[model samples]
Target chain A: MLSESETMSRFFESWRRSIFDPDIPFRRKALDVFRHQVSHVPIYARFCDTLGIDLSAESDDDNTTGSDDDNTTGSDIDNTTGSDIDPTTGSGINPPSGPKKNPAISQYSDAAIPLMPIQVFRDLLIRPDYLTIPEAVFRSSGTSGSRQSTHEIADLTLYEESCLRGFGRFYDPEQFAVRAWLPGYSDNPNSSLVAMIDTLIRHDRSGLSRFLPLDQPMHESDFDDIREQNKRIMLFGAAFGLMDLVDSGAPALPSGSVVVETGGMKTRRREIPKQELHHRLAEGFAIPRDAVHSEYGMAEMCSQAWNNGSGWFACPPWLKITIRDPQYPMELLSPGKEGLIGVADLANVHSLSFILTQDRGVMRQDGTFQVLGRWDHAELRGCNFLMES
Target chain B: MMQSDGQITRICKAVDAWLGNESGLLEQARERTISDGLFTLHDVGHMLEQVARTVTCEAITAWVEKSRDSYAVQNSGRKDSAVYDKNVLCLHAGNLPMIGLQDIIATLLSGARYHGKLSARDPWLLDGLLRLLQKQLPENVITWSTNLDDFEELRADRILFAGSEASVEPVTSRLWELRAAGKAARFLNRTARFSIAWLSGKDVEELRNKTSGAESPGLLNDLVEAVMRYEGRGCRSVAVVVAPCELSDVAGTLIPALQDYVKKYPFLHSIKPEKSYWASYLETMDRDFFESGPIILTGDTDLMGKEDVVCWISGDAMTVQQIFEKAGPKVQSIYTVENPLPLYTEALSRAQKPPIDWKPDGVDVLRWLSG
Candidate 1:
């Protein structure tokens, strides 16, 4: 049977080839994603309404004629090459009449696009709309002094597809068995990680599924069942929660377990350093130090960025990231300039492609991004203190 | 010596006669001094000088210390210490009597602090003596002008009237505009009223020890009255207490204890209804103790009850602990005896002790005014 690592590697490889097809036009892919998002999710409809952006206008410029679907207005594709028939159409193909108004687009020249603020995202989620996947909606457990915020979970099918695609891009599928600790999900049926694992098990070829140190509370378990099985296990849990299991004197995991921890540990145990946390997880899980990967995904977006056991994360081919000046969202910054990080996920065609995150990050010339930390005074200081500690 | 005593007696008698026969007039003058500081002068020379200044169209007028209330005291003799209301045209240093001339000169010099000008005789002795007498008299002895026209006609460096924000906003805006135009103006900002929380003592020894002095009972009564004045909303007012005695016993003791104060200040009763409102309010915030009314018998020796009309009772042992844990640093004062309940001790320790260095975040005008 293929081990967990093998399955992950194989899944990510397959996903990379399928999603990043060089032959597929970017506009077709964008539209396909947009349709999937609006038809399946209720949040998109309300968000478009709130922004006063007409969804009908999205397909009005295309010259290829197509029937109106439940989520679509119309499809009219433009036959003109480089220049449209009507000069008034401003869909990049036609030029303006008076002094060539609006700047010309160049292949090598990068231009800035306007992005929405975090408040708009918050307003989108707060609307009272009936959703299809009720279990996918999760409220973040707020800190002691503040109220919790609700996050909409991407549809399970979409999530599975994305995860599979993500996994297939990075690894070979035949060498590892799929086993996960799933600590956060062990107690809750509706946990996002649990749902993701369930999808993996259904599609896994290893024919072996085990959630270990089961039937016991978090403190009672010494090591995960997957660790005891002595196979290549994919460890999934929050950074702090895993550290807590380790700190409670749990024995090390069996060798070859690939640790995939998510989210920043700053909010949880503020004392632990990220490097130390990763090191401890590697030590306690009995996994290779380099196998301890960190994945960054928010409830608002579908695409996930894997740290690949490195300090930086790379976006998938279909996804594009834009670094904006933190003070001015309209200005696109240079590759190395540290500013607010915004994501353009074709995966989020169900939602808005451009999500303006509160996180601050810097993009390297290699297209990899390093998350600086959360913006704003308290969070910035808190993350800095955590790093220092 | 007999002649000297007779002369002193005659001066005293004359002063007393003047004060007793026209007490209302003296009261009016005192109010005027508090309000404007420069009003009608009894002496014609000073009055004429003021009229001349007005006639000549000088925007600013100086009244060289003409009022006797502005006198300085240098002697133990009551005759020399008497304050006169007569105004003088000018205050020249050389015109003083030789014996107490130094004091008069000092008084005249001190008048410079309040912007008084000296052109002739030293008028400080009369001015200082008058201020001292005004301080000696009760606040109620001072009378306000019934003549609205006179009050309106009199120009002021500044005038402030205290009221609630909603009630005073328009007036404040108008006054602020006037002040911008170089007219002296101010508006009193109203604040939320507060009451006291009294923790009565069950231990007779502790109660006796704390209230040992002759002034202790009056001070305690003052504390309770202070609480009721705000209906228990003011930051200074105590909202809850631990009674040393039984509920009924504490109430009985407090009623009589507060009687003298109520009589002295009739405005004390105006706060009674507010006290009742406060009691209910406290009860609503904390149901267990306040809902049961006064005299919450925790069955322990520790007596706890609300002292004023807005008293909150901590019926359970944990209530006291909770209060201690939640007590912020802004508490004004706490009354307690040695080693009372542990919770009470902790709370008292946390209560704002003197030499308070911290200020509350927002502008609390009531506290500012009271302080």
Candidate 2:
């Protein structure tokens, strides 16, 4: 039997391998979510029917064969390697050839797994049985006057494992002390910053942990404490919140202190230019501007995508990110073309990973990505709006 | 703060005047609201808060105290008077500061008998408000029950009765029979002939402003259209407008506005024609009188001065009024918007006062109906 560290490392390697290995786990998870939607979610089933895809036809046989009994399943279907062979074809399931394949496959099956609408997603969360997989649930402090949206978290153990494995690939854990400047809430049960700190304590061997005093009505004295402590900090918070601390005359930190912030600042307080925000944070913390990182994740998905100290965010091996044309949902844009960002997280076994996010982003050749805010208008295709509506 | 007996008397007189006349008028003003089964203890509380705020009371809690005192004194001689306890009375005041007192008063005046001393500290106030409001406006309130028993109860009411020609005949048969027998009854019916109207798309922002009183700009049009669609009512069934007008040109302009409204609310197609027709007929009559200039159609034009027919505009939207002039032994309630129309803010403040015998115009209608 492997040691704890060995077991952890193996999980990390498997996750990394899954990213490059056609994102099979993610696809399978997507199929599972889709199956659940068609069978249990009445609204989703009706929507699918309207789209000409008979969800009822998606049988248990299709799960194994990756083919519907009718030609309706489409041609670009890639069969799993381990699946039993079909008696008629005599060969392993291959991509359908030529014209018959192009229209049928293109029309029927999505090249990537489809995302449930926002309305359906919201409804699913309200279900008592939803996210019954014993995962931690986090709720966004809803836009003023709006209902809050609940985000189901993967098991803390799974999250810790994923975070360590993903962050370990690029940084040495032992060398850096994790210091966070997350805003503390007295009443909120599901604060992302609090969760981050909890995860850090579980993994970090460094006894040092500093929470930056950046609460509302913040004073310069809060930063003074951080500066006096004289330790490397991994500042984590919303972009705007951190910037406010810097603006309020918070002193800079040591050179090695790294800043990592998650989520977007679009609908929150006033948003500053990304470079300007970084510059102010760097000036206040006395660290390199590149040290500031931004991470992205949605309430529905389990895993997170992190920006690697640089402006670009990198997905883990088990996660696949696709940037598709905003106007055309089917057309996957090449690198450099800006469009909607779609993520397939293999770790999302309980929910859907094939989420068509409202965010606008660009895909780079290196597979790293940069987000450019949310879509100006609601996209017509996805189920995300349905959940919101 | 009083310097003389005269000042005290004047203040009392003003309060008395409001209690004796304005209160009754305001009640009458809300006749439709009450009859619609939409107003609840929370709504009454909201109105009381409005009234208390208007009176510039130091705090709503004080008003609630005064109202409870008044109620106690008024009912002291009665053997079977309802008790008013602060803990027992559920206050439905929102987060707005200085409105709690008025809400309590409104509750008392609305005939919600209370027991025990009135206290605003009760934690159940919010929950009670929500529950009562849901009960009052079940259609508007979306309910989700996690409890299996509650879910089953809700499921019984969840039968989706689809509309079709085949289904309409049987559904209306019972109602027709009751109508033929001269028995009063309410029946649910469906029809498809509705058109939504709006002043303009730009009016949406103005409509969202809480302080703005302009009949919610396009909202009046939407409401009219919704009512029309409720039973296949056409344009004539509901005449939603930015301004009440009599000119043919102004009436014609409303047609084009319907296009924009339809784009936003497609459900407008479901309005019934008869409802729209009635709404339009009423609107046309209003326009005919107001077209020459702003005019109050209620009462005789010669007897009342121009000021009497006050056209109180809230953020540029016209208020709707139903008028009755004939004195009769009529069972139906007569409703009218009062002169010097009460601002929403002011009305909410006054509602916090102690329960009084004063009847607003709308309440007069209720009294008339009950009699």
Candidate 3:
């Protein structure tokens, strides 16, 4: 008999069948995962307690706390504010006794779930209490001397599976020799991007995958070997690192090869817009402009959004993106409106699924989105500075 | 100031011309300032007027001359020009319009090269103003950029930064490392803070007694201006008003003043509904709030509230002191009408209109730049 506590079983089944099953009830699954995390993740449960979100009580699907739920039309979220914060004891509310999985309690709007700020991962150790032994800790690539965000992984296989299956949605990782040219990232063992790339490269059944040498001349012999093996170069790199490769004269690759630019260059090179950067990379790498791809991911998130040749990025079925009003963070903006980006990744279940990122983007009606740029005033938030610290 | 040198005179001329001109750069600056989203067109208008009125040549000359009397703050006529020819980088905050004006003036009058990284919010106006002065001054007088890479890479002989504590700590840590390695200079850093207004029971009683049928209370407009200015985005803008009695006791006096403020700035009445972020949060929590359209009086109790929100706390001397004690380094200034304060306290009106030599975060930037 299959135990009811087997939560990962459903997630893995969904992950395997989600590509083919277009009619999967994402809301129900998201709500289930959200309820699961609220019960098990201590840090997240504590945050929710501070927000006065009562998870023990069964809630309606669209029952938002505020009267402004009518305004939250485009996204799955409805704005939820804190309720009944204990005055004397403060927000020192403890987690529920144990993980309560009730069939009748599978209901919650997106807003009912609090979007933890990305900084929380940096300031505190966030993981499911049951799984105290983190398989790995992936950190952000911050500026020198800056505190980077640490994402403690409960399961390494979960991440590898998320990477391989997520990548497999677009292209077969085996057919393409997964070649990555990450300069700032490759050296760091804690870099999630590096880990993701490493995992993808390792899964390359052709055995022609490797990290390209940095700041050094790319040997034609290496390219010849890939060319000899009749495999396409799935070249992945940080934007600036790729540009450095372009400047150092990246050799022309075989046709059908892809150039993936992980969006960044803030500290390294003179910054350029994503479109202009893509065009330059396409020209420099001797690939068709359509072959240049952009990815939207962060150390705080489990899944990555991919852009095909255009500026717009498409999320895999497991990920949900919402555009939120920057000033009125509680209200969700309609489609075509530019606002701060909020992500709810099902794969991020081990930690917290919902995250309010520092990025600004606009989501189209088709679930595709375009990352505008970093919101500088994203630091305007100063609520409960102690809690934040 | 420095015997009214040719460059200073030319800079004064540039200021005069820039201030007098109507629809050119000022209009461009006004548009840019409004686009920052924190400010409105009317707010930009008032800010420009404030800047124009206070940043006159005489005022500049007086402040410069007074500072020079204390130290050998020579920039131009130094026989050892290299010794005094230091580059000062001013990484400014965007809370107020031309907030770094005093810093720039100090750098220029001290004869140091001014390297600036303007806050993205109020860049166009300051950039344009500096360019006007730059045309009349030496080529190396000013240089600035809004690029992230440039900011991360560029370092100077001296640094003046005003931002949040979170932003400053890392920079401070990096500077300390650099200094230990003998690669950095002495610097002054100001982090995020807010001002508060303290109202005694006597003060509230006075307002109540003075209130008649048609007229408002005494000096309340200026006090209201403290919160009304820049939508309370300035560090000196009072975010908290501590009254010795219940807010209901003086609601008549306080509400009308706020109403008058709304009359003065109709934009406050028409604030985007989406901007009621704190208000919504309070409602969802089912907590009591004293809301006035854009200005919310919530229990946030923050040292600095966001955009247009303010905190209203009722307390006696000890209670007020407790609030200030909790504030610590985060308190920028204390504003009061009658009661005497030990230090770092200003008259109610001066909270909104500080003097030319006003030391932000109690640090005399001019003294540091000159000496």
Candidate 4:
């Protein structure tokens, strides 16, 4: 048995290697991490057990919900919502009110791997008791007046590495002066996005990189001067915050400067379509619509996916995106099919690696995905006050 | 100035008169609500019909008759009728457009000195109606205040608040404060709640016949019409679908049905994309959650506590019963398709047929309001 520090160090090492190994099979790494987490993370382990996926057993437990083998024969059909077959169970009547028996998976597929509901992190720290105490805790913004999700990191160094490498892989940091107008996250030191941006700023090595203060308006002249200096700039702001800057008569930035928008308008303003928002930002910044980037991330995962003006986002090498049929969690949707997003971030080794998100998106053949909006049933959590422009 | 029954009849007649006129205050109210994006013009028309039916002389007469027979207050009130004239401060929730109109009418019929604080979200519709009522009734009979503090300042013997669950505590505490200060009051607090619909196979089949076609999963159309009314923002809206055990496969049929219906009838007051994104973000983090079009299906039976609006829950009869037990006071209405109404009688304040009135949760306002 290894000490907690040693176990975490091993995960970090695996992540570092995986980032450089794109050719590595997704499932092989995912399954390896899944099996490891089942033994270490209590919440995740219980979830797998409930789903009847026992890693330690001679074979993966095949306890499936509803009657997949013979949908007509599974549970007694009773009339509640008028004889409509329950989507999940072939026959309804609550499956005999006892523990769900393990149903055999005909084939060993990635879908068979049990997923931890993403909400567990919002209400519980995914930290196992045997694991080392977390050195830092990152929280989602609670601007919506609901409780926010918090990610406890046993190893801050691993997170720093993940953020820098994941970002550096997509866009070169040294060439750009990272100018972020992320007031909501920046104000809260525990914010993961703020910490990630801080890393980007530090990596820029230039004094030009900094989070702009909300109260103090940066004159257009100052921004223009930075462009004149021949420095590439990445301007990041919350969607609504960026809207405010433009609405306040802020002139277009120098060409080639990247404007990345993260958090949505929330309740600060009436919700606008992403196309309209991007167009407005592009028109205001004098940049191509594609020049306006979107960052898809949350406190629940260790990795962030980036969309460079294309409506679709692509995850980094260590992170994988899986679109699953919302009604059937075990069923994976093909490319171009809209479904719920399931993320398997190898960098999330310290916590639960498999996270099923509430975002609705369509995966393309090339693996890039476009987020449609929210799954209507997803609960709105916390205040997004800081995102208001 | 008039007998309670006569005063109620006059107010009902005034509303009917306004509604009948092509260019009356009711029309103006309807148009304003449409323009405000609170409800679509079609749905507003639907809401007006419910309002019209609720205040009819027939409905009022039957209600008064029932209350006189059932309420102890009525039997004893003739000797000590002073309580009948007590002031009732009405705090109307604006979540559902014109949701306060029923209560406003009820308060007036109770012969209480009705002072209402209308929801800011929907100030125009009810205000227009009230102003029309003032034209026929004396000023002493009914009135509305501009602000909560002003409503609070006026003399009141009873308090009636209809709002979100979160408002319950603060309102109660404020009333407590008022009582501590020597201004005591009796109260009825109606908080946020959602409704459920239970269907049998026969019900699904009939729904199919009435909508689209025989094999097209007509229950989906029925649910969409019920839940998506007012964009699923109102308490009367059917938020949860409780189905029979054999119909577990209904989830699959309903998901696609929802997608098609939403595309056909776009939400008038749709949720903002940003908030939707945040909600999705929060949901993706949870394992027990799943989505099917506008309907979210969850294995977590206790979703009522979370106020999960617009979702379907699958369970056996016993599981659903347990859920109802757990959901207890939060559940407002449970509509059963083929099952007997008595099956859910205990679970709800009143188990009625399909088209339910937009009443406050946990209370039968008309029953208590009529004397």
Specify the highest-DockQ model's number: 3
Residue-level lDDT tens digits of model 1 in B22-141: 445445544444244222222222222322323121111111121222222222244542112111111112111111212222222222111122211223323433343333332211
Fnat per predicted structure, each in turn:
0.00, 0.00, 0.06, 0.00
What clash pairs does model 3 have? Answer: none
What is the TM-score (0 to 1) of candidate 4? 0.50
**What value does the TM-score of chain B take for model 4?**
0.80
At residue A53, give the lDDT of candidate 3.
56
**Which lDDT tens digits does candidate 1 get at residues A71-119?**
2423332233211211112222221123322221111111222234443
For A100-126, candidate 2 gives per-residue lDDT tens digits of 212221224433444433423433453
The CAPRI-style docking tier of model 3 reads: incorrect
Report, for all candidates in order, the number of backbone clashes: 78, 89, 0, 50
Error of 3 at B332 (Å): 15
Deviation from native of the Cα of residue A237 in model 2, angstroms: 1.9
- Tens digit per residue, CA lDDT, model 4, A1-389: 55545544554554456534565445445544565566567777666554545334422222322232343222221222222222223232132223334432222454556555676777787885445568788887766565788888766777778788878877877667888886566667788888788877777666778878777886766566467668877888889889988898766788787889885666378767778889999998888898999888878877889997777899886788888766454557999776788888877766888887867778999989877665533122100001000
Q: Is candidate 2 or candidate 3 better by TM-score?
A: 3
Choose the strongest candidate by lDDT.
3
Q: Scoring model 1 with DockQ, what do you get?
A: 0.01
Better of 1 and 4 by TM-score: 4
For residue A1, what is the lDDT in candidate 3? 35
**Ten-residue region with minimum lDDT total, candidate 2 chain B:** B323-332
Q: What i-RMS does each candidate reach, in Å?
A: 26.5, 22.4, 9.7, 10.7
